[model samples]
Target: MNPPKRPGRRAVCLLVLFSVWWVAVATVGFSAETVSSEPQVKAAFLINFAKYADWPSNAFEKANSPIVLGVMGDNKVSEELQKVIAGRVINGREIVLKRANSIDEAGACHILFISNAEQQHTPTVLDQVKGHVLTVGESPEFLEKGGVINLVRKDQKIALEVNLTAADKAQIKISSKLLSVATLVKGKAN
Candidate 1:
Protein backbone atom coordinates (compact mmCIF):
# COMPACT_ATOMS: atom_id res chain seq x y z
CA MET A 1 0.00 0.00 0.00
CA ASN A 2 0.99 3.67 0.44
CA PRO A 3 4.14 3.72 2.55
CA PRO A 4 2.41 1.84 5.38
CA LYS A 5 0.76 4.64 7.33
CA ARG A 6 3.16 5.59 10.11
CA PRO A 7 2.07 6.15 13.76
CA GLY A 8 1.67 9.71 12.50
CA ARG A 9 -0.59 12.76 13.03
CA ARG A 10 -3.42 11.04 14.88
CA ALA A 11 -1.09 9.37 17.34
CA VAL A 12 0.83 12.60 17.86
CA CYS A 13 -2.35 14.52 18.55
CA LEU A 14 -3.51 11.95 21.09
CA LEU A 15 -0.15 12.06 22.83
CA VAL A 16 -0.36 15.82 23.12
CA LEU A 17 -3.87 15.66 24.50
CA PHE A 18 -2.82 13.14 27.13
CA SER A 19 0.10 15.29 28.14
CA VAL A 20 -2.13 18.33 28.52
CA TRP A 21 -4.62 16.44 30.63
CA TRP A 22 -1.89 15.25 32.95
CA VAL A 23 -0.42 18.71 33.34
CA ALA A 24 -3.83 20.10 34.14
CA VAL A 25 -4.59 17.70 36.99
CA ALA A 26 -1.10 18.09 38.33
CA THR A 27 -1.71 21.81 38.57
CA VAL A 28 -5.17 21.29 40.05
CA GLY A 29 -3.52 19.70 43.08
CA PHE A 30 -5.50 21.75 45.68
CA SER A 31 -6.98 25.12 44.72
CA ALA A 32 -10.51 26.29 44.09
CA GLU A 33 -9.36 29.01 41.70
CA THR A 34 -7.71 26.31 39.65
CA VAL A 35 -10.66 24.01 40.04
CA SER A 36 -11.71 24.77 36.51
CA SER A 37 -8.26 23.97 35.18
CA GLU A 38 -8.76 20.25 34.74
CA PRO A 39 -12.18 19.71 33.28
CA GLN A 40 -11.12 16.20 32.36
CA VAL A 41 -10.53 15.31 36.01
CA LYS A 42 -14.13 16.10 36.79
CA ALA A 43 -15.23 14.23 33.69
CA ALA A 44 -13.15 11.23 34.68
CA PHE A 45 -14.65 11.26 38.14
CA LEU A 46 -18.18 11.27 36.74
CA ILE A 47 -17.40 8.49 34.31
CA ASN A 48 -15.80 6.38 37.00
CA PHE A 49 -18.60 7.06 39.41
CA ALA A 50 -21.06 5.73 36.87
CA LYS A 51 -19.09 2.52 36.47
CA TYR A 52 -18.88 1.83 40.20
CA ALA A 53 -22.33 3.04 41.15
CA ASP A 54 -25.69 1.37 40.83
CA TRP A 55 -28.30 4.04 40.29
CA PRO A 56 -31.88 3.32 41.16
CA SER A 57 -33.53 1.39 38.34
CA ASN A 58 -36.09 4.06 37.85
CA ALA A 59 -33.39 6.67 37.16
CA PHE A 60 -30.93 4.58 35.17
CA GLU A 61 -32.03 1.10 34.20
CA LYS A 62 -35.56 1.37 32.89
CA ALA A 63 -35.81 4.72 31.17
CA ASN A 64 -32.29 5.31 29.89
CA SER A 65 -32.79 9.02 30.24
CA PRO A 66 -29.98 11.55 30.57
CA ILE A 67 -28.08 11.50 33.85
CA VAL A 68 -28.78 14.74 35.67
CA LEU A 69 -26.26 16.70 37.77
CA GLY A 70 -28.00 18.87 40.31
CA VAL A 71 -26.70 22.02 41.97
CA MET A 72 -28.26 23.47 45.03
CA GLY A 73 -27.89 26.98 46.57
CA ASP A 74 -24.75 28.58 45.13
CA ASN A 75 -25.10 29.77 41.56
CA LYS A 76 -21.41 30.42 40.90
CA VAL A 77 -20.34 26.83 41.34
CA SER A 78 -23.25 25.71 39.23
CA GLU A 79 -22.19 28.05 36.47
CA GLU A 80 -18.61 26.81 36.64
CA LEU A 81 -19.78 23.20 36.59
CA GLN A 82 -22.10 23.81 33.68
CA LYS A 83 -19.26 25.22 31.63
CA VAL A 84 -17.00 22.28 32.38
CA ILE A 85 -19.54 19.53 31.67
CA ALA A 86 -21.45 21.33 28.96
CA GLY A 87 -21.49 18.74 26.23
CA ARG A 88 -20.06 15.74 28.01
CA VAL A 89 -21.79 12.40 28.02
CA ILE A 90 -21.51 9.59 30.51
CA ASN A 91 -22.77 6.01 30.34
CA GLY A 92 -24.71 6.55 27.11
CA ARG A 93 -26.51 9.56 28.48
CA GLU A 94 -25.93 13.25 28.02
CA ILE A 95 -25.16 15.21 31.19
CA VAL A 96 -27.64 17.85 32.23
CA LEU A 97 -27.56 20.34 35.11
CA LYS A 98 -30.48 21.52 37.21
CA ARG A 99 -30.61 24.18 39.88
CA ALA A 100 -32.58 23.64 43.06
CA ASN A 101 -33.41 25.63 46.15
CA SER A 102 -34.35 22.57 48.15
CA ILE A 103 -33.41 18.90 48.24
CA ASP A 104 -36.95 18.03 47.37
CA GLU A 105 -36.57 19.94 44.14
CA ALA A 106 -33.22 18.35 43.43
CA GLY A 107 -34.41 14.82 44.19
CA ALA A 108 -34.10 13.50 40.65
CA CYS A 109 -30.40 14.22 40.12
CA HIS A 110 -27.93 11.35 40.08
CA ILE A 111 -25.26 13.61 41.58
CA LEU A 112 -26.00 16.53 43.88
CA PHE A 113 -23.37 19.21 44.42
CA ILE A 114 -24.13 21.30 47.47
CA SER A 115 -22.63 24.75 47.74
CA ASN A 116 -21.62 26.78 50.80
CA ALA A 117 -24.94 28.54 50.57
CA GLU A 118 -26.60 25.21 51.22
CA GLN A 119 -24.70 24.53 54.44
CA GLN A 120 -27.40 25.82 56.72
CA HIS A 121 -29.91 23.51 55.08
CA THR A 122 -27.60 20.51 54.56
CA PRO A 123 -29.02 18.35 57.30
CA THR A 124 -32.47 18.50 55.82
CA VAL A 125 -31.11 18.02 52.34
CA LEU A 126 -28.95 15.06 53.41
CA ASP A 127 -31.97 13.50 55.04
CA GLN A 128 -33.92 13.73 51.82
CA VAL A 129 -31.14 12.02 49.89
CA LYS A 130 -30.09 9.64 52.67
CA GLY A 131 -30.44 6.43 50.70
CA HIS A 132 -30.69 7.85 47.22
CA VAL A 133 -28.44 10.50 45.69
CA LEU A 134 -24.68 10.89 45.70
CA THR A 135 -23.79 14.08 47.57
CA VAL A 136 -20.77 16.23 46.71
CA GLY A 137 -19.68 19.43 48.43
CA GLU A 138 -16.89 21.99 48.85
CA SER A 139 -17.46 22.86 52.49
CA PRO A 140 -14.71 22.16 55.07
CA GLU A 141 -17.12 20.10 57.15
CA PHE A 142 -18.50 18.20 54.22
CA LEU A 143 -17.16 14.82 55.24
CA GLU A 144 -17.89 15.41 58.90
CA LYS A 145 -21.46 16.23 57.96
CA GLY A 146 -21.90 13.03 55.94
CA GLY A 147 -21.27 14.24 52.39
CA VAL A 148 -20.03 11.48 50.10
CA ILE A 149 -17.36 13.55 48.34
CA ASN A 150 -15.74 16.63 49.76
CA LEU A 151 -13.71 18.89 47.49
CA VAL A 152 -11.15 20.58 49.68
CA ARG A 153 -8.32 22.97 49.03
CA LYS A 154 -4.94 21.91 50.36
CA ASP A 155 -1.54 23.42 49.70
CA GLN A 156 -3.32 25.61 47.18
CA LYS A 157 -4.48 22.56 45.25
CA ILE A 158 -7.86 20.87 45.11
CA ALA A 159 -8.05 17.46 46.77
CA LEU A 160 -10.88 15.10 47.44
CA GLU A 161 -12.08 13.84 50.81
CA VAL A 162 -14.33 10.81 50.64
CA ASN A 163 -16.86 9.51 53.11
CA LEU A 164 -17.24 5.81 52.46
CA THR A 165 -19.96 5.37 55.04
CA ALA A 166 -22.20 7.94 53.42
CA ALA A 167 -21.61 6.45 49.99
CA ASP A 168 -22.36 2.97 51.28
CA LYS A 169 -25.55 4.08 52.94
CA ALA A 170 -26.61 5.75 49.69
CA GLN A 171 -25.92 2.47 47.88
CA ILE A 172 -23.32 4.16 45.72
CA LYS A 173 -20.14 2.19 45.17
CA ILE A 174 -17.02 4.33 44.86
CA SER A 175 -14.11 2.90 42.92
CA SER A 176 -11.06 1.86 44.88
CA LYS A 177 -8.93 3.76 42.41
CA LEU A 178 -10.74 6.96 43.35
CA LEU A 179 -10.63 6.11 47.05
CA SER A 180 -6.95 5.31 46.86
CA VAL A 181 -6.07 8.80 45.67
CA ALA A 182 -8.50 10.51 47.99
CA THR A 183 -8.38 11.15 51.73
CA LEU A 184 -10.83 8.79 53.37
CA VAL A 185 -12.86 10.22 56.21
CA LYS A 186 -14.74 7.84 58.44
CA GLY A 187 -17.49 9.05 60.75
CA LYS A 188 -15.98 7.14 63.64
CA ALA A 189 -12.63 8.91 63.36
CA ASN A 190 -14.07 12.35 63.96
Candidate 2:
Protein backbone atom coordinates (compact mmCIF):
# COMPACT_ATOMS: atom_id res chain seq x y z
CA MET A 1 0.00 0.00 0.00
CA ASN A 2 1.08 3.55 -0.64
CA PRO A 3 1.79 5.84 2.27
CA PRO A 4 -0.65 8.60 3.23
CA LYS A 5 0.12 12.12 2.08
CA ARG A 6 1.89 14.41 4.56
CA PRO A 7 -0.19 17.30 5.94
CA GLY A 8 -0.40 21.07 6.14
CA ARG A 9 1.48 24.41 5.66
CA ARG A 10 3.65 23.90 8.72
CA ALA A 11 4.88 20.60 7.34
CA VAL A 12 5.74 22.24 4.04
CA CYS A 13 7.49 25.06 5.83
CA LEU A 14 9.54 22.66 7.90
CA LEU A 15 10.56 20.75 4.79
CA VAL A 16 11.66 23.89 3.00
CA LEU A 17 13.57 25.15 5.99
CA PHE A 18 15.41 21.86 6.35
CA SER A 19 16.12 21.65 2.65
CA VAL A 20 17.77 25.03 2.92
CA TRP A 21 19.69 23.88 5.97
CA TRP A 22 20.72 20.69 4.18
CA VAL A 23 21.92 22.58 1.15
CA ALA A 24 23.73 25.15 3.23
CA VAL A 25 25.39 22.51 5.32
CA ALA A 26 26.31 20.53 2.22
CA THR A 27 27.84 23.68 0.82
CA VAL A 28 29.35 25.15 3.96
CA GLY A 29 31.95 23.74 6.32
CA PHE A 30 30.99 21.78 9.46
CA SER A 31 28.27 23.86 11.00
CA ALA A 32 25.23 22.32 12.66
CA GLU A 33 23.94 20.46 9.63
CA THR A 34 27.49 20.00 8.43
CA VAL A 35 27.88 17.34 11.06
CA SER A 36 24.21 16.41 11.18
CA SER A 37 21.08 17.21 9.14
CA GLU A 38 19.81 19.79 11.58
CA PRO A 39 16.59 18.37 13.03
CA GLN A 40 15.46 16.21 10.13
CA VAL A 41 18.24 13.67 9.86
CA LYS A 42 18.89 13.74 13.57
CA ALA A 43 15.24 13.01 14.34
CA ALA A 44 15.10 10.36 11.66
CA PHE A 45 18.19 8.78 13.18
CA LEU A 46 16.65 8.95 16.63
CA ILE A 47 13.41 7.36 15.50
CA ASN A 48 15.22 4.80 13.43
CA PHE A 49 17.57 4.23 16.31
CA ALA A 50 14.54 3.42 18.42
CA LYS A 51 13.46 0.83 15.88
CA TYR A 52 16.91 -0.70 16.13
CA ALA A 53 16.96 -0.55 19.91
CA ASP A 54 14.94 -2.51 22.38
CA TRP A 55 14.42 -1.12 25.86
CA PRO A 56 13.57 -3.37 28.72
CA SER A 57 10.19 -2.96 30.34
CA ASN A 58 9.97 -0.04 32.77
CA ALA A 59 12.30 2.05 30.70
CA PHE A 60 9.62 4.70 30.80
CA GLU A 61 8.13 6.20 33.90
CA LYS A 62 4.76 5.62 32.34
CA ALA A 63 4.29 2.96 29.71
CA ASN A 64 2.09 5.28 27.67
CA SER A 65 4.25 8.40 27.53
CA PRO A 66 6.43 9.06 24.54
CA ILE A 67 10.05 8.01 24.85
CA VAL A 68 12.09 11.06 25.80
CA LEU A 69 15.32 11.92 23.97
CA GLY A 70 17.38 14.02 26.36
CA VAL A 71 19.73 16.52 24.76
CA MET A 72 22.25 17.70 27.31
CA GLY A 73 23.51 20.94 25.84
CA ASP A 74 22.57 24.07 23.96
CA ASN A 75 23.16 23.77 20.26
CA LYS A 76 21.48 23.90 16.87
CA VAL A 77 21.04 20.13 17.12
CA SER A 78 18.67 20.39 20.06
CA GLU A 79 16.43 22.84 18.23
CA GLU A 80 16.28 20.48 15.30
CA LEU A 81 15.58 17.46 17.47
CA GLN A 82 12.58 19.19 19.04
CA LYS A 83 11.20 20.08 15.66
CA VAL A 84 11.69 16.60 14.24
CA ILE A 85 10.06 14.62 17.04
CA ALA A 86 7.16 17.05 17.32
CA GLY A 87 4.37 14.53 17.03
CA ARG A 88 5.82 11.07 16.68
CA VAL A 89 5.25 8.03 18.79
CA ILE A 90 7.63 5.25 19.71
CA ASN A 91 6.62 1.82 20.98
CA GLY A 92 3.27 3.16 22.12
CA ARG A 93 5.05 6.08 23.73
CA GLU A 94 5.02 9.60 22.34
CA ILE A 95 8.42 11.05 21.37
CA VAL A 96 9.66 13.98 23.42
CA LEU A 97 12.85 16.05 23.58
CA LYS A 98 14.17 17.49 26.78
CA ARG A 99 17.10 19.89 27.10
CA ALA A 100 19.59 19.49 29.89
CA ASN A 101 22.30 21.86 31.00
CA SER A 102 23.98 19.29 33.20
CA ILE A 103 23.88 15.53 33.20
CA ASP A 104 22.19 15.48 36.54
CA GLU A 105 19.35 17.54 35.10
CA ALA A 106 18.82 14.94 32.43
CA GLY A 107 16.70 12.37 34.12
CA ALA A 108 14.59 9.66 32.45
CA CYS A 109 15.79 10.01 28.89
CA HIS A 110 15.85 6.95 26.65
CA ILE A 111 18.23 8.35 24.04
CA LEU A 112 20.86 10.97 24.70
CA PHE A 113 22.60 12.92 21.95
CA ILE A 114 25.87 14.41 23.19
CA SER A 115 26.86 17.34 21.00
CA ASN A 116 30.50 17.34 19.87
CA ALA A 117 30.99 20.78 21.42
CA GLU A 118 30.46 19.14 24.77
CA GLN A 119 33.54 16.96 24.54
CA GLN A 120 35.05 18.31 27.70
CA HIS A 121 32.50 16.53 29.86
CA THR A 122 31.82 13.49 27.69
CA PRO A 123 33.30 11.02 30.12
CA THR A 124 31.19 12.26 32.99
CA VAL A 125 28.14 12.46 30.73
CA LEU A 126 28.67 8.91 29.59
CA ASP A 127 29.12 7.82 33.16
CA GLN A 128 25.83 9.38 34.11
CA VAL A 129 24.00 7.80 31.19
CA LYS A 130 25.60 4.37 31.19
CA GLY A 131 23.25 1.41 31.45
CA HIS A 132 20.24 3.69 31.21
CA VAL A 133 20.26 5.75 28.03
CA LEU A 134 21.44 4.92 24.51
CA THR A 135 24.00 7.63 23.77
CA VAL A 136 24.75 9.13 20.33
CA GLY A 137 27.49 11.62 19.62
CA GLU A 138 29.76 13.19 16.99
CA SER A 139 33.00 12.75 18.91
CA PRO A 140 35.26 10.07 17.38
CA GLU A 141 36.39 8.97 20.80
CA PHE A 142 32.81 8.45 21.99
CA LEU A 143 32.99 4.69 21.62
CA GLU A 144 36.37 4.63 23.25
CA LYS A 145 34.87 6.74 26.02
CA GLY A 146 32.07 4.19 26.55
CA GLY A 147 29.31 5.80 24.49
CA VAL A 148 27.07 3.41 22.55
CA ILE A 149 26.70 5.16 19.18
CA ASN A 150 29.15 7.50 17.52
CA LEU A 151 27.67 9.56 14.71
CA VAL A 152 30.24 10.57 12.14
CA ARG A 153 30.23 12.72 9.02
CA LYS A 154 31.34 10.77 5.96
CA ASP A 155 31.09 12.27 2.45
CA GLN A 156 28.91 14.98 3.99
CA LYS A 157 26.43 12.43 5.29
CA ILE A 158 25.95 11.04 8.74
CA ALA A 159 27.22 7.53 9.39
CA LEU A 160 27.05 5.51 12.59
CA GLU A 161 29.46 3.55 14.77
CA VAL A 162 28.06 1.29 17.43
CA ASN A 163 29.37 -0.52 20.45
CA LEU A 164 27.16 -3.57 20.81
CA THR A 165 28.49 -4.54 24.19
CA ALA A 166 27.71 -1.10 25.58
CA ALA A 167 24.26 -1.16 24.06
CA ASP A 168 23.65 -4.61 25.51
CA LYS A 169 24.82 -3.40 28.86
CA ALA A 170 22.24 -0.61 28.66
CA GLN A 171 19.62 -3.31 28.05
CA ILE A 172 19.12 -1.88 24.61
CA LYS A 173 18.75 -4.23 21.64
CA ILE A 174 20.23 -3.31 18.29
CA SER A 175 18.40 -4.43 15.19
CA SER A 176 20.42 -6.57 12.83
CA LYS A 177 18.91 -4.64 9.95
CA LEU A 178 20.29 -1.36 11.30
CA LEU A 179 23.57 -3.06 12.14
CA SER A 180 23.84 -4.22 8.54
CA VAL A 181 24.34 -0.59 7.50
CA ALA A 182 26.33 0.58 10.51
CA THR A 183 29.97 0.09 11.48
CA LEU A 184 29.84 -2.28 14.44
CA VAL A 185 32.63 -1.94 16.99
CA LYS A 186 34.08 -3.43 20.15
CA GLY A 187 31.83 -6.46 20.34
CA LYS A 188 30.72 -9.67 18.67
CA ALA A 189 28.95 -9.12 15.35
CA ASN A 190 25.33 -8.16 15.76
Candidate 3:
Protein backbone atom coordinates (compact mmCIF):
# COMPACT_ATOMS: atom_id res chain seq x y z
CA MET A 1 0.00 0.00 0.00
CA ASN A 2 1.21 3.55 -0.76
CA PRO A 3 2.13 5.74 2.24
CA PRO A 4 -0.12 8.78 2.97
CA LYS A 5 1.37 12.00 1.66
CA ARG A 6 1.71 14.96 4.02
CA PRO A 7 0.75 18.50 3.02
CA GLY A 8 3.62 20.52 1.50
CA ARG A 9 5.11 23.65 3.17
CA ARG A 10 3.36 25.94 0.70
CA ALA A 11 0.04 24.31 1.48
CA VAL A 12 0.60 24.73 5.20
CA CYS A 13 1.52 28.39 4.78
CA LEU A 14 -1.59 29.02 2.69
CA LEU A 15 -3.73 27.32 5.29
CA VAL A 16 -2.32 29.48 8.08
CA LEU A 17 -2.86 32.64 6.08
CA PHE A 18 -6.41 31.64 5.26
CA SER A 19 -7.21 30.94 8.89
CA VAL A 20 -5.92 34.34 9.98
CA TRP A 21 -7.85 36.10 7.27
CA TRP A 22 -11.00 34.20 8.15
CA VAL A 23 -10.78 35.17 11.82
CA ALA A 24 -10.26 38.82 10.97
CA VAL A 25 -13.16 38.93 8.55
CA ALA A 26 -15.49 36.71 10.54
CA THR A 27 -15.11 38.80 13.67
CA VAL A 28 -15.61 42.10 11.89
CA GLY A 29 -18.14 41.08 9.28
CA PHE A 30 -21.82 40.99 10.09
CA SER A 31 -23.21 37.67 11.32
CA ALA A 32 -26.88 36.80 10.65
CA GLU A 33 -28.13 37.63 14.13
CA THR A 34 -26.10 40.86 14.32
CA VAL A 35 -26.96 41.99 10.80
CA SER A 36 -28.14 45.49 11.61
CA SER A 37 -27.38 49.19 11.11
CA GLU A 38 -24.47 51.08 9.57
CA PRO A 39 -23.57 52.53 12.94
CA GLN A 40 -23.16 49.03 14.37
CA VAL A 41 -20.86 48.04 11.53
CA LYS A 42 -18.73 51.09 12.15
CA ALA A 43 -18.66 50.19 15.81
CA ALA A 44 -17.42 46.71 14.96
CA PHE A 45 -14.66 48.27 12.89
CA LEU A 46 -13.65 50.43 15.85
CA ILE A 47 -13.45 47.39 18.11
CA ASN A 48 -11.39 45.43 15.60
CA PHE A 49 -9.17 48.46 15.03
CA ALA A 50 -8.06 48.16 18.63
CA LYS A 51 -7.35 44.49 18.12
CA TYR A 52 -5.28 44.83 14.92
CA ALA A 53 -3.42 48.01 15.85
CA ASP A 54 -0.33 48.65 17.95
CA TRP A 55 0.02 51.88 19.85
CA PRO A 56 3.28 53.35 21.11
CA SER A 57 4.31 52.30 24.62
CA ASN A 58 4.04 55.80 25.97
CA ALA A 59 0.47 56.23 24.74
CA PHE A 60 -0.74 54.47 27.84
CA GLU A 61 -0.25 55.56 31.45
CA LYS A 62 0.87 52.10 32.55
CA ALA A 63 0.77 48.44 31.53
CA ASN A 64 -2.77 48.16 32.87
CA SER A 65 -4.23 51.42 31.63
CA PRO A 66 -7.49 51.10 29.75
CA ILE A 67 -7.61 51.72 26.02
CA VAL A 68 -10.10 54.47 25.42
CA LEU A 69 -12.25 54.84 22.30
CA GLY A 70 -13.75 58.27 21.98
CA VAL A 71 -16.62 59.06 19.65
CA MET A 72 -17.55 62.49 18.36
CA GLY A 73 -20.39 64.04 16.31
CA ASP A 74 -22.93 61.22 16.35
CA ASN A 75 -24.79 59.92 19.35
CA LYS A 76 -25.95 56.75 17.63
CA VAL A 77 -22.39 55.63 16.87
CA SER A 78 -21.21 56.33 20.38
CA GLU A 79 -24.09 54.35 21.86
CA GLU A 80 -23.49 51.48 19.47
CA LEU A 81 -19.77 51.39 20.16
CA GLN A 82 -20.44 51.31 23.88
CA LYS A 83 -22.85 48.41 23.50
CA VAL A 84 -20.39 46.36 21.42
CA ILE A 85 -17.36 46.92 23.65
CA ALA A 86 -18.93 46.65 27.06
CA GLY A 87 -17.15 44.13 29.33
CA ARG A 88 -14.58 43.45 26.63
CA VAL A 89 -10.81 43.58 27.04
CA ILE A 90 -8.53 44.21 24.08
CA ASN A 91 -4.75 43.76 23.98
CA GLY A 92 -4.88 42.87 27.69
CA ARG A 93 -6.35 46.31 28.37
CA GLU A 94 -9.90 47.16 29.32
CA ILE A 95 -11.92 48.82 26.57
CA VAL A 96 -13.71 52.02 27.47
CA LEU A 97 -15.97 54.16 25.31
CA LYS A 98 -16.29 57.87 25.77
CA ARG A 99 -18.66 60.30 24.10
CA ALA A 100 -16.37 63.21 23.42
CA ASN A 101 -17.81 66.70 23.75
CA SER A 102 -15.18 68.30 21.53
CA ILE A 103 -12.30 67.51 19.20
CA ASP A 104 -9.86 68.49 21.93
CA GLU A 105 -11.40 65.99 24.28
CA ALA A 106 -11.06 63.23 21.70
CA GLY A 107 -7.39 63.96 21.11
CA ALA A 108 -6.56 62.05 24.29
CA CYS A 109 -8.25 58.87 23.13
CA HIS A 110 -6.56 55.89 21.51
CA ILE A 111 -9.12 55.64 18.69
CA LEU A 112 -11.38 58.46 17.62
CA PHE A 113 -14.32 57.90 15.29
CA ILE A 114 -15.31 61.19 13.69
CA SER A 115 -18.86 60.91 12.44
CA ASN A 116 -20.33 62.32 9.20
CA ALA A 117 -22.14 64.86 11.33
CA GLU A 118 -18.70 66.35 11.93
CA GLN A 119 -18.02 66.59 8.19
CA GLN A 120 -17.73 70.36 8.08
CA HIS A 121 -14.98 70.32 10.72
CA THR A 122 -12.96 67.56 9.08
CA PRO A 123 -9.91 69.59 8.22
CA THR A 124 -9.76 71.33 11.56
CA VAL A 125 -10.36 68.14 13.49
CA LEU A 126 -7.75 66.24 11.52
CA ASP A 127 -5.26 69.02 12.14
CA GLN A 128 -5.86 68.83 15.88
CA VAL A 129 -5.54 65.04 16.14
CA LYS A 130 -2.72 64.52 13.66
CA GLY A 131 -0.05 62.04 14.82
CA HIS A 132 -1.96 61.57 18.06
CA VAL A 133 -4.70 58.98 17.56
CA LEU A 134 -6.26 56.67 15.00
CA THR A 135 -8.93 58.74 13.25
CA VAL A 136 -11.68 57.02 11.26
CA GLY A 137 -14.06 59.10 9.22
CA GLU A 138 -16.48 58.46 6.37
CA SER A 139 -15.77 61.59 4.35
CA PRO A 140 -13.81 61.61 1.09
CA GLU A 141 -11.30 64.19 2.32
CA PHE A 142 -10.57 62.37 5.58
CA LEU A 143 -7.34 60.58 4.68
CA GLU A 144 -6.05 63.53 2.64
CA LYS A 145 -6.38 65.61 5.75
CA GLY A 146 -4.04 63.28 7.76
CA GLY A 147 -6.39 60.69 9.21
CA VAL A 148 -4.70 57.35 9.88
CA ILE A 149 -7.69 55.40 8.53
CA ASN A 150 -10.96 56.13 6.82
CA LEU A 151 -14.03 53.94 6.39
CA VAL A 152 -14.99 54.45 2.77
CA ARG A 153 -18.28 53.61 1.12
CA LYS A 154 -17.73 52.05 -2.30
CA ASP A 155 -20.09 49.96 -4.43
CA GLN A 156 -22.66 50.02 -1.64
CA LYS A 157 -20.20 48.23 0.67
CA ILE A 158 -18.03 49.46 3.50
CA ALA A 159 -14.28 49.38 2.92
CA LEU A 160 -11.22 50.54 4.81
CA GLU A 161 -8.96 53.28 3.46
CA VAL A 162 -5.60 53.33 5.23
CA ASN A 163 -3.10 56.17 5.23
CA LEU A 164 0.18 54.36 5.90
CA THR A 165 2.26 57.53 5.88
CA ALA A 166 -0.06 59.13 8.38
CA ALA A 167 0.03 56.03 10.57
CA ASP A 168 3.84 55.92 10.40
CA LYS A 169 4.11 59.56 11.36
CA ALA A 170 1.79 58.94 14.27
CA GLN A 171 4.02 56.06 15.47
CA ILE A 172 1.15 53.60 15.09
CA LYS A 173 1.78 50.13 13.70
CA ILE A 174 -1.13 48.50 11.94
CA SER A 175 -0.99 44.73 11.49
CA SER A 176 -0.36 43.37 8.01
CA LYS A 177 -3.54 41.31 8.32
CA LEU A 178 -5.48 44.54 8.63
CA LEU A 179 -3.64 46.30 5.81
CA SER A 180 -4.21 43.39 3.47
CA VAL A 181 -7.90 44.29 3.38
CA ALA A 182 -7.51 48.08 3.17
CA THR A 183 -7.28 50.45 0.23
CA LEU A 184 -3.97 52.21 0.90
CA VAL A 185 -3.55 55.97 0.46
CA LYS A 186 -0.69 58.43 0.75
CA GLY A 187 -0.95 61.28 3.18
CA LYS A 188 0.62 64.74 2.76
CA ALA A 189 3.91 64.80 4.63
CA ASN A 190 4.60 67.40 7.28
Off by over 4 Å in 2: 1-39, 187-190
Residue range 33-132, candidate 3, lDDT tens digits: 5766888888889988998889999989999899889888988888888787888888789989987667678778888888889888878877776435
- Clashing pairs in model 2, backbone N/Cα/C closer than 3 A: 66-93, 66-94
Evaluate model 3: give its lDDT: 0.83
Clashes of each: 7, 2, 0
Q: After superposition, how far is residue 53 of candidate 3 from its true place, in Å?
A: 1.1
Q: Rank by TM-score, descending?
A: 3, 2, 1
| Each model's Cα RMSD | 8.4, 10.8, 7.4
Model 3 TM-score, all chains together: 0.79
Winner by lDDT = 3
TM-scores for every candidate against the unseen true structure: 0.70, 0.73, 0.79
Residue-level lDDT for 133 in candidate 1:
78
- Candidate 3 collision pairs: none
Give lDDT per model, in order. 0.70, 0.75, 0.83
- In candidate 1, which residue ranges exceed 4 Å CA deviation? 1-52, 56-58, 61-63, 188-190
